[model samples]
Target: MDRITLAFWSLVIGLCGATAFFVTGIYGQQATQQQREAKLESGDLVQLVKVIDGDTVVVSKEGQPNATVRLLGIKTLESKHGKDEVAVYGRAAEEALKRLVGDKPLRVLLNTPPRDRHGRTIATLYAGDQDIGLGLISQGHALVYSVYPFASMPVYLQAQTTARANNLGLWGDPEVSAKAEAMINEWARQGS
Candidate 1:
């Protein structure tokens, strides 16, 4: 190759590497800084504050108040923002999550290693023996995240199959059935 051509290719490769580092903080890897945060120590008990949506929650542990927790292994429909109307099945999904975690008094715990780019704790939540994200998927309120494997993957996949077979929640609603997974893939594709 000519010297000029080689130099140009080198510059382009360097620029792409630099951009990926600053943008996603890792090359060809998806977990953000937040998701890369230190894993919660085993046996730490964190209390649920409230459900943020179908898959996120506000929680606290001892001194840390209102820590954001993202449910591992699943993603739900986007909830309404500001004065905007609820996305199709959004409210129902959120409500379903709330019912699953209602006043029976529940606590959240993380079996995952890190948080998301938003600095939200990535976690697996259970109310007694029930897995929260799996419950959402089974009810058709959520889907397997697919970005990374979680501890309960097989069961979550089974739940998703059952939910799909039954046409529950988002899967059941033709209005969003096509767009829902696309939005999720787009969001992940953009790494936001």
Candidate 2:
């Protein structure tokens, strides 16, 4: 074969190999994304294994390991390692979540990208028709997590406004509200 023809064929083969690599990579990424979406489909029923706090819980899906789920669009006071007033409100939040969830199976709805920086799955859990995250905000046990963008942000904010207006739960107590506000600001600062 002529040197020119041999060089042309070699170049064509290299280009074909590169194209195949890129195409495979794109398809592989799509497959991975699809798997993630399918892993926690909306309306998947899960048992509430434990309430970590007002905004977090341990849940068990059928045939899957227990997962730590952080409620989307809400932040609860620290239930551990805080002063008396903060801890008081924090525990109140936990109890409120427990009461809301009871022993019922939760309908899990995941947020885009699903996982948080801490590797916990970020989800909005529902007990029947009630959104557990919104319920906490409505009861003033949680603050609307405005730091992160989520689909329920607007509704969560509205619930929090009503809770504040009614002086329900944490908002009813001036001391707790002040402490929670300070903590939330600090959290925002850390996140930024």
Q: How do all models score by TM-score? A: 0.68, 0.74
Global lDDT of each candidate:
0.72, 0.85
Evaluate model 2: give its lDDT: 0.85
Report the C-alpha displacement of residue 170, candidate 2, in angstroms. 1.0
Model 1 lDDT, residue 59, Cα: 61
Model 2 misplaced regions, further than 4 Å = 1-39, 183-192
Candidate that would win on lDDT: 2
Off by over 4 Å in 1: 1-40, 62-64, 81-86, 181-192
Query: Which candidate leads in TM-score?
Result: 2
Global fold similarity of model 1 (TM-score): 0.68
Model 1's alpha-carbon lDDT is: 0.72
Give the 10-residue window scoring lowest on summed lDDT in candidate 2.
30-39
User: Candidate 2, residues 1-192: lDDT per residue as tens digits?
Assistant: 999999999999999999999999987886564444325667799989988888989888888667778999888888896777878788989999999999999999988888876667889999999999999999999998777777888898888889989999889999888876786687678657
Q: What's the lDDT for residue 111 in model 1? A: 49
